[model samples]
Target chain A: MHTAEVLASRLGLDIAVAELERLFSQPGADPPDYGLDGGHRRPIRVAYQGVRGSYCHEAATTSFPSAAAVEAFPSGFWMEDAFSTLESGSADRAIIPAENSLDGPIDRNLDLLLRHPAVRITGELVVPVNHCLLAAPGVEISDLRRIVSHPQALGHCERRLQSLDLEVEEVDDAAEAARAVAEDRIRDTAVIGSRIAAKEFGLRIMEQSIHDEGGNYNRFLQLGVGDGPLYCGENRKTTVAFSLEKGVSGLFRALWVFESRGIRVTKVDHRPNRANPVRLVNRAGGVELAQMDYVFVVDVEGSELDPRVAAAVAGLGEFSGFVRVLGSYACTCGA
Target chain B: MHTAEVLASRLGLDIAVAELERLFSQPGADPPDYGLDGGHRRPIRVAYQGVRGSYCHEAATTSFPSAAAVEAFPSGFWMEDAFSTLESGSADRAIIPAENSLDGPIDRNLDLLLRHPAVRITGELVVPVNHCLLAAPGVEISDLRRIVSHPQALGHCERRLQSLDLEVEEVDDAAEAARAVAEDRIRDTAVIGSRIAAKEFGLRIMEQSIHDEGGNYNRFLQLGVGDGPLYCGENRKTTVAFSLEKGVSGLFRALWVFESRGIRVTKVDHRPNRANPVRLVNRAGGVELAQMDYVFVVDVEGSELDPRVAAAVAGLGEFSGFVRVLGSYACTCGA
Candidate 1:
């Protein structure tokens, strides 16, 4: 009867009418299967840090067209491996969670961008962070004794899980938890992961979107291995990381370069220059030493071709840490 | 005989030495409550979001030299009221959780910062997050029918809480749970909050840190009405929020303002821009229109007085949505 139901029926997309009710019961909620969009243009081999049906995987599907062959990694550390796959002749691109709507920035991802100067911000995909309580086929709610998932997933599902009165367990990832259930590690075990994982792994959706805080979305970055596509009519975004030298006013002098140069910084963020700490002196003549890690990210609106932007960064003296230029790309989704 | 016993006596302060080891121990892998710096600070008026002896009050006492008055706010929002009071002639300053190392950023507090731009960041404090299952004086875990606390607090104690095998209820805060027992609202109900709440409100510590994740420390922000000590020494830090206008290209443009200016950023993070959504446009077409609201939070190496820092920001132009100079206090502790 619903338009989405008709679309689902025609597309042969495995969308259940009842499941749609659960995820979209709230007003303004969109259907899970965004169906196929001409926007993606081509098939994208997305590299995420988890197994199939994970939230990352779901996000990748939304960002790309036909994620037929997904390359998976065990931890975030392997994202570079995936990125390398994109860089070399293996994969097309990678999908990495730059930040979470609920949890702030994923620090490791930020560190990865800083450490690996090659990856550039091509485009971003925002995915709703909806998680569900899943159980294997034939199992019912009464059969569940323990619930497992990533810690945050567990946190999100706490209220619903508590209502079920099941034992809670912590796992490395939601997909892994589902995998555990598939292997029949414990008949009473259930996992809090994506509904897609539930469907892929043949787990029933016991519950969904248990997070008390609504409007959860994850901003994912699409990284191009090489110099990305030039901007046309599309919106654009650029990302970079830099830092200052150490001294009585070293950092102060460093910042003055930007203001003097006449550049508008859209985003400026930092991560400990994992490389080093700085020495600081206090009023009490207390000398405390710390290897200062450099601040690593900055973004803005404009073209690198702008002479002012180029001259500004050059003016800063010897940066004690890294100063990198990531990349600039056109935003595909036109607002 | 023990370190706490010796320290309590030496401090010349009224420190109620509880058996922390015994107090924090659990039946199978309960969390540890590495006693915080509380019970050591010089007496002062420390405001908290709960009744006397609440965990926050405990944190406040530890923060000061000798806390003379432990002011209790009904909720965290009231703590904001208290911060306003400190500004409008009531309290001096207040410490609030910005993030938990284990759980993640205290998003609510960050949201608060976005609203109350006047609050300045004084310094950062680290407090070990400990969640305990508490019961009334005469009751035990087995007699408990329901466990209650703020949602995240309950999640931290999820595993231990699951093990208790009791029903769960949601409450406003930890001390409220303690107050539940103190007021005799639920005779057999168990509260999962802080150990300080148990002792302060005369409840029993049924179990310790229920959170499965062990490395838990909440990052507390000391906020005041106006400018704090400007020069944060070695570990000196600054917090500011900004936004970008359209047509941003190359992160270099953004970084040029900072890197060229010599002002180093320590952390760069993104928040949803509630006012303006990130515009996405494709050459042909892709996803529909969207406007995202976001705020960029940055931590610099020094005070705003740093000329380079000011110039860089000036260059940042209209791309910056807002600029709130948090504070210029140096960290007394070595990074």
Candidate 2:
């Protein structure tokens, strides 16, 4: 038996490299069937934002390493497209970027998750970004004129690229930028992007480990298309998005939901509300045009199935727009 | 009316030109007191991490703009020293940068804020940054051998600085960088800093508006030595810091506190929980070292006095190792 397979078995997990390879290579292979008291359980297909070379792809791979093949989406907006795919019996799970260590929170994605309240937290992936500067093979630094990459990758490598004295142009994604450098449109130009992008687009690595910190990482969430997992590790985490109702004291009352129990929270983020539109309405009409309800993303300790978590979700329904749970999953504490 | 004062009154906020004038003058004055409650509330002093000519100084001026005055510290760490001052009744508040639009969150400051629970968010200041490359009179880019500034300032102007072929030296803040240029210890050394620092040190403008985004701004939070005002406007926001209790599910249950309340949070940041130090017991006993807890900084829409907020806080108490109200105040919202 392989070491990885042995480790997986010792941990009581059904993961093996060969199993994962087969799952991804298969076409809509039915996942393991687990019979519930009511009926047969349906396996899920998940979607996420980003190109093939994006770290998010790695996150999706981590979620069900040995399960049936799942579908992937191109962008976060397409995750909504995945929702339609799920409705059409194609995908059942959607993964999203909820927060990051350096970036703080992914507010826009939170809005998307809240817009789709049916999704639940099933698992999570923490992907460390190892950004690499890439160029055409055998291309030297002094020969470069312009450096291109995603706007975010640009921000991450700003210091290093500025030192290289290259003209920095923003691109949609690092992988796309790598593709640009490969097309040979501009011989002297290079791309400030990811190693994944370089390896994917057949570009050469010019420099590696350019981020200001070596610990740059992002947290990806596995969002269930329906009710969440029934059981998870004791260290599981859950997410909920909410908006408060009236009464100056209602916010105070809401705190009782979790602190009333013993469950703890790990993180939270807030963004412009997507549900209730705030409009520049004529005072007499009070009409909604754009948005009114601002959403709050909360990450708490414990799975939704836990009694405390279940009670809190059910209890907090007194709110106006408290209608979303992004995901919940067990996490390794030490990592 | 003074230009800044005119801007303040037109903005319909507590902005005074006099406080700004004082800030530009001395090293030690009580930090400005932004009216926390209203026209009747006592003013709160703010301690910021920088001298007269730093972005933090500008942020402090905008938040308070009235008597008690402004106190400036030399480094970001000294802001904590100033926080110690607030803790010891030497200063009334501290304004620290929590995040920036371009560079992402200040991880160190977030970690610091989490460790210091006594300090609360009394108010917030949004300071527009127009970074410029400053140098000595008659100095040209060709003559420059080194560029110095805070890491953040260097980062802010990273793209524009390419091709200069100068060695980048990181300093504590813009003021220090300007000081270094003025002392002439490092000839041919220019500083990428603020106009305030440039003017204070009599440095010439080497480059104007070097930031990639013209409207780049940094978000600063005013932390008061005392509790927040008795009441706030209907549009006030509440801040809280918490650590999950041991064996707690972690982040999501705490989220349910707000999710159930119908309360919406505007921002949330994770800071290292310093209170829980790693304990080392004698090797014979094998007593486990204490694990570090993660601190969450949450800004929700509403005041602490709100019942929903009360319920949220109450509920949080059960799962939280520690939870405290940062503060609440009305501010200019995007709406």
Residue-pair clashes per prediction, in order, are: 75, 70
Error of 2 at B44 (Å): 19
Alpha-carbon shift of residue B279 in model 1 (angstroms): 9.6
Judge candidate 2 at residue A228 and give its lDDT.
31
Query: Candidate 2 — what's its lDDT?
Result: 0.58
Tens-digit per-residue lDDT, A1-335, candidate 1: 57976664534322222222222112223434543454222223456655677777776555433233233332243556656656664554566767665555666666667666677666666656778878887888888778888887777666687677878888777787787687774578888888778777787887778776554666667665656444423344455566656532354345445545655465555555433333333433444332223464666444455566566556653653546667654333211
lDDT of 2 by residue, A75-156 (tens): 4445466455544545555566655544445655565565656655555555556678788887888888888777767776
* Lowest lDDT 10-residue stretch of candidate 1 chain A: A17-26
lDDT of 1 by residue, B88-181 (tens): 6454456665555433444456556777777776666555667777778778666778878888777767777777778888887668768768
Best by DockQ: 1
Give the whole-model CA lDDT for all candidates, comma-separated.
0.56, 0.58
- Residue range B70-138, candidate 2, lDDT tens digits: 444433446566567667765556667755654445566555555566766665554556778888888
Off by over 4 Å in 1: A1-45, A67-92, A138-146, A158-167, A185-189, A206-210, A246-264, A279-293, A302-322, A331-335, B1-335
